[model samples]
Target chain A: MLIPMAKLQIAGRREELSAVLEGIYRLQGMQLVDVARDPALDVDAAGLNDANSLTQARLELLVARLDALLALVGSDDRGDSRLHGDPDPVSGAVDLADVEAELDRISILVQEAAQHLDSLTDELAVLPRYLHPLEQLARLVPELAALPEYELQKLGLDTAALVLNTSDDTLVDTLRRELTEVFGVRFDLTSARVGTDAIGCLLVFSHSDSARLHALLGQEHVRHLPLPSAYSGQSLFGALAGMRTRLDALPRELADAHQVLEELIGPHVEAWHVTLAGARAELEQLAAAAGAGVTDRAFAVVGWVPRPHVARFHEALAALSMGPLAIEELPHDERAHSTPVLMKERRVARPFGLLTRFLDNPRAASLDPTGLMALFLPLMFGVMVGDVVYGTALLLVGLWARRKFGRISPGIADLCSVLVFGAIWAIIFGFLFGEALGNLGKNLFGDFSLWFYRGDANALQPLLLFALAIGAAHVLLGVVLGMWQSWRDRAHRHLLDRVGTFAFLCGMLGLAGFAAGALPPGFMSPAIALTVVGLVLVMSLHGTLGLIMAPLELLGAIGNILSYLRLAAVGLASVYLAIVANELATVGPLWLGIIVATFFHVLNLALAGFSPMIQALRLHYVEFFSKFFIGGGQAFIPFGKSHS
Target chain B: MDIGIGLIAIGAALAVGISALATGLAQARIGAAAMGAIAEKPELAGRAILLVAIPETLVILGFAVAAMAILLLPA
Candidate 1:
């Protein structure tokens, strides 16, 4: 049901405004409307640009920081929904300064630890590049302590290193010969087997000829290997040993840093969340208040509050001791176009309410269709997926999901309830159809007493007729809902139009049956008479244009009814697929047959299950909702809450 | 099978096969647009699903026609 809202204007002394707003925050039931934009308010409102007013950017920054802190401590609640939590305490009672200081300290420590871990990991990653070639060089030449500058100069050389595949050993000789000719520089090169397939080569050339040697090497496609900064000024063995020690210690150091950060912050995660939530709630209230129009000494806050809670809201305001405060309920008629919508439903209907929110919230004046959809969607689903064994499996899965994930999210629990309801309907239809995973039960039981006729080719006509009848009833209900909406708005012409359309549909259906010789001769005359009367009535409202549109409306209604044939058609497909599975299984060896049957049955179950659920919802949204759902209402959002 | 029965079978196959192709073609476009819509706004998932399922009626109607054709055959 759509809850009625009463418009409220709250006025209080400037000094006591925060206290009054805090009381309203604790109530957490009013959606504040910006009174500055109210046409009734004077254009020359005072204190609109008050120096003391909090800026929106500052409020956002505070909220973001709190969110960052919550995430850092692993207590972020951005999209995760927990099914159970303690009710919120009253607003702005606790001081968050000490927690803020602790959060700041922990944030810095965590950042430092993260940075240190990153560098260590980076060092460990590149260690292999240096270690691999150096280990090979040490093994190939046992006393090649380091590159000797004197030995290097013997060939007019300075040191450089190159890595290559074993095939590229020939490329090194080419590089040496090419360099001697192109750069006129002599070179000495040493090669070591680094990895299984790759060789490490060290080259020496005259310092004066180094630049020419590099160009010549590039031309020969010889890649250079530069030693890491840590390896500089150390012998190959010493650098290799140093790198091994660092690599071994890095993992332990990273683990210890993680342990320390976790130990420091993990215990306080819950407290940090609560503190941050409190701070956010306060900041949100201030932001909401900043939108209100103010006089020299007082502020006026205009908002919409649920009608039943108006008195309770007043009582909370009275406790604030804001002297000579004015709290008045502006009639809903005053702001009909802007009234925010709040849907109040019973606990059982809550999940359907969530589903309704997928579309726009219903207008404040419009009917809430959550209850209607909840009742009908599952019934349609059951009819379209009639199979007892499949239904039972669905029920079990829904129950298991509800039990396992209910505490994690209420939305998921509600969705499971919808599935459970559909499963119940499925079981009912399954019995009616006498199906269990495509006649497996019939084949095994040999004409069991519990069986109804299988929904085979013979049952097609009656099932189609049944689906049409359901469509007719559903469309008629939509007409009634339209009339109810018209009645609420006191639009008598619209009421007449809806009633006329209903009569026209009835006459059209009656005429169709009579023309098919399915009805008595007596029905023909009255069907024609009803059609004329409905036509005249509809024409009276829409004038001559209604004459042209009336037949089109009837056609649309007929088309909608024909659309329900999917229920029968999809159900038949499921049965046929199940039969195919059984047939395939029987063709092979017993074990092989069982495997084939299981595979096909699972595929059929998935298709049959998901298709019906989606089709049922589509029928409701397109064929059903078009009747009276004029959605575009703003959802009621109360101030002083971090999330709705 | 009799010639009449064979013709009925052929008609049923044509009705189902042609309409199934039509449904697949329609759904391919609708499903892609629905996915793009859902990526932009996650809450649109329910409505997108309803839109994607709308084209399925083509196949269902074809199935009905096929069933009618099969019923023309003798038991």
Candidate 2:
């Protein structure tokens, strides 16, 4: 049922307005409307900018900062186990100065920690550069250190090492020859055999000849290992040992930095989320006040509260102040064009309500079709997919999906509910049609229908006729509902329009039956008489054009009814496909046949599943909804409420 | 003179095949636009599917015609 709303206009002293708004926000029932739009109230636009504007702006800034902090911590409210157990009570107004100070203090610590982590990351990145050379130097450090240190310095020499690991022994001899004989550079080549196919050599060359000798040995797969600037002129073993110690300590230091940052931020995440929620609630109240108009002494606020909530709204405000306050319920006629719509849906129908909202909310004064949709949509779907085996499979899949993903997304849960309902209908129709998975039941039980034949093409007439009957009933229901709405609104002409259409449908069906030789000849008189009366009634309102158009409307209604034949038609197709699959499966050996049949049945189930759902929704949205539903009302939004 | 069954087969084939073709042609455009709409707003997926399935009425009509052909054949 769609909830009826009453317009709530609350007037109170300007000073008490904040407290009143807080009380309403806590109640979480009233959907606030802009009072400036209400022409009956003499609202001062400039007076809206009260002391709350500056405070609201500050609160908005704080919320943004807190959001950034939450993101930085990489945690969301939904994933937290603590948030699931108990709901938080609404907090009192937070002092802006206190919140600003807290956020500022935390933000500074977070920035400093982040900077520390970044510097550690930067140092760790460069550590690999030093570590790679330090490892190589550590391997060859003793050999180079054993050389006469004074002579090494007295020769004004600089050192370069080459670790040759490639499969090129000739390149090693060429390097030794190039430095000593061909270049005639003062260089000492101290070579050490490291491993099979790898040789490590250290070159101590005169400073004047270092550039030429270095360029000479640059090729031939000789990798020049350069030491860090700090260890360049130091004793090779001492420098290697010192660098290795530093390299070993860097990883531990990096780990400590990470652990420290995590420890600083991890414990505070829950507290920050709660603080942010409280501050956000207060901020939203300030925003509502900014939209409302106020005077020097009193302020006026207009909003919609469901009729049942009127007493609660009054009681909450009364508790705020013992002094008399003006609370008036505006008449329904005074509501603005964009009145928010609120509905109290039945629990069973709540999931189906997702489909209704998928289209648009029903108009505030229009009839709600959610309850009817829950009944017809699944019925239409079941008729289309009438097969027991497929229905059971769909039921199992829907049940599994509901358990796995129901909490993750409301849409998935709604879809699961729809699927479960469709499957139940499918099972009922399946039993009636005697189809387990296509002709499997027919072959096993000798092909007899429990209610009516649906297995062969020759047996499709009954299904088609049944579909037409269903369409007639559905269309009649829509027409009756439209007439009821019209009667409620006291639009006699609209009511007449619906009644004429209803009469026209009866007359046309009767005539069609007579023409098909399914009705007695005597029925023609009443059929023609009814059709003429319907035309006259419709023509009364639509003028001369209605005389010609009313008959076309009757034909259109017939077409709409005939359109339901698709339900039977598609079901027949599914049955035929399943039969073909069974026949094809038998073309092979026993094991192969079993595999083939399973594959085909699975394919048929999938194809048959989604199409019926889509078609059922289409029948409801187009054929059924076209009769009465006029949606487009805005959904109700309570003050300070956050949509998840 | 005894070719009634063959003629019925041809009629049923034409009915089902041609209607399927027509539905395919109509759904092509609707499906493409629905996909584009869904890309912009995922909430439109349910409505988009309904729109895309509207053209399937052609196939249903064809199936009905084929069924009629088969059922109406003389024994």
What TM-score results for chain B in every one of the models? 0.95, 0.91
lDDT of 2: 0.77
Model 1 residue A605 lDDT score: 81
The parts of candidate 2 lying over 4 Å away from their true place are A45-51, A81-89, A112-261, A316-323, A334-337, A446-448, A490-496, A532-555, B41-47
Tell me the TM-score of model 1: 0.81
Candidate 1 lDDT over residue span A1-644, tens digit each:
88888888888787776677777777777888766666765523333245335343444554576676456435555432421363364434445456556657777877786677667778879998778776766565443445553443454435567778765567667656766676563655677667777778776556777787778668767677766887764444556778889888888987886676667667766565565566566666666667676867878778888888899888877776667788887655622667788888877677778778776688887888999988888889998888889999889988999999977888889888888889988988888777888788778875442434454546777787778888888887988898898888888998888888788778888998898789999998888887777778887787778778766776676677778888777777788889899999989799999999999999988886678877787888877877777677788888754443
Docking class for model 1 is medium
Find the 10 residues in a row with the least total lDDT in model 2 chain A: A81-90
Best by lDDT: 2
Give each model's whole-structure lDDT: 0.75, 0.77
Q: How much DockQ does model 1 earn?
A: 0.59
What is the Cα-based TM-score of model 2?
Answer: 0.77
In the range A349-389, model 2's lDDT, one tens digit per residue, is 88898899887788887888999999999999999888888
Residue A166 of model 1: what lDDT? 69
Interface RMSD of each: 2.0, 2.3
Q: In Å, what is the interface RMSD of model 1?
A: 2.0
